[model samples]
Target: MARARSEERRAEILRAALEVIAERGYRGASLASVAERVGLTQQGLLHHFPTKEALLIAVLEERDQWDTGGAGLSREAWRLDLLEPLVEYNAMRPGIVQTFSALLGESVSDGHPAKDFFTERYATVRGGMGAALRAEFGNRLPGGLTPEQAAPLLVAVMDGLQYQWLLDPESVDMPGAFRDFLGLLRGAGDGPRG
Candidate 1:
């Protein structure tokens, strides 16, 4: 019973932490703020996460596998199972997107706890997206752009688009952008498609 209760409290704190961090940048976030978000005391927050860094790292780690086993992240193909679920998740949990964007800004310094995590994550995500593209257009792409060369560029485009969409929600359609980006990756048509 005690273990279950502890786990529940930790989950509560993590959910509240996501909101707090997303609303207020990492530098602006504090244990006190998190506690207020979830109606806990600052000391209560500390019981689960001894420090801000601990909480931040835990949140990021949890996000890593919260939906694990649902998506096969690989360097060969994209199971619609994987990308579609992420698309669904993004719609269901806009907070996750906000939290993810917040962390990208926070994960700059090599000494920052979140830096390495984001770095590796971006690498894997970029690689996976690239690999999926290569599978779709291995022989058709002009000059045979390798996955290694194309993956990072695709990820960069997605990241840049994410920023713009966040700033002007009405100005951008994420799914449409993703579809167009995928087309570009496969050396398909140049302009937007319906």
Candidate 2:
């Protein structure tokens, strides 16, 4: 019973943190606001995370974990894995998607927490997406293009598409878009002409 309560409180805190961060960019979120969201006092929240930066770091790590869900994912196959979840993730939490997009800009600065987070995150995801592509179309791509060549663009498109969908979701056909992506990747043997 005690363990259950602890686990429940942890989840509540995590969810509250995500909501606060999603609503307010990483810089704007206040501990007071997050505590209120979870019915805890600021000091109470402090018991869980000692400082705002630490909490923000926790939030970023949690988002990455929640986003990836521990699949021991190969960087090469990350894009394929992201495919089924991206549409749902975008529809359910456009704010989170927006927050992630916004963080990319911030990550350019030296020593930003998200800088390391995204650097590792992208490396992992890129590797997984590349692996997935090679697995599916190893023989279908250009003589030299390889899955690595196409992985980045495909990821960029998906990320960009999320922004577009957030602006006008009705314009996107989520599954069909992914299907077309696969088709293009499969036909990459023809590759893009010079």
Candidate 3:
């Protein structure tokens, strides 16, 4: 069970790192802070992660794995129905959402470690979204815009809603707002039906 214990410790470190990153953003979070959270010395933490960048990458990948339901990632188009549930799921995990938002905001600058990761991730996410839109609406999604055009908007809405919800959770109904956006995606004047 040595391997099992090692894996558990690593997961604990990642959770601690997420909390630190959520509080301090990627640039400000230090390995010592994460190590202390996991009851380890800084050198001990280094033994596991080697470097802060490696730990950050692990945290990001873990977040993605959680988002994708641990099925690894599916390149195929996501079903339109899954979007709302995903948003609702996100609402239940405020820490993860905050960490993601914090990293995304910080990654906009030049040469950030996460800059390339987010850039590549968005391209893949956009492609999946475009495929989903095309599968649902064929060449053009009711508004005369192609799926390629709408895909980025879809990503924007999801991330934008997260930012709004993070700022004022009491005011932003993230899942509901996302459902409304999906309606807009489907067609104008096609608001959610009872």
* lDDT pick, better of 1 and 3: 3
Tens-place lDDT per residue, model 3, 130-192, is: 888899899999877899999899999999999999899999889888888887877876555
Model 3 ranges off by over 4 Å:
1-9, 16-30, 50-53, 188-194
Question: Model 2, range 1-194, lDDT digits (tens) per residue?
Answer: 98898778877887888877777755567889889999999999898877776676666666666566654444532546557666655666766666666677677899876688678777777777778778766834643468888768777877777767766878876545665665566554333333
Error in Å for residue 58 of model 3: 1.9
Considering every candidate listed, which one attains the maximal TM-score? 3
Error of 2 at 45 (Å): 2.2
Local error of candidate 1 at residue 93 (angstroms):
4.2
What TM-score does prediction 2 earn?
0.70
Total colliding residue pairs, candidate 1: 0
Give the best candidate by lDDT.
3
Model 1 residue runs over 4 Å out of place are 1-5, 19-30, 37-39, 67-81, 84-93, 130-143, 190-194
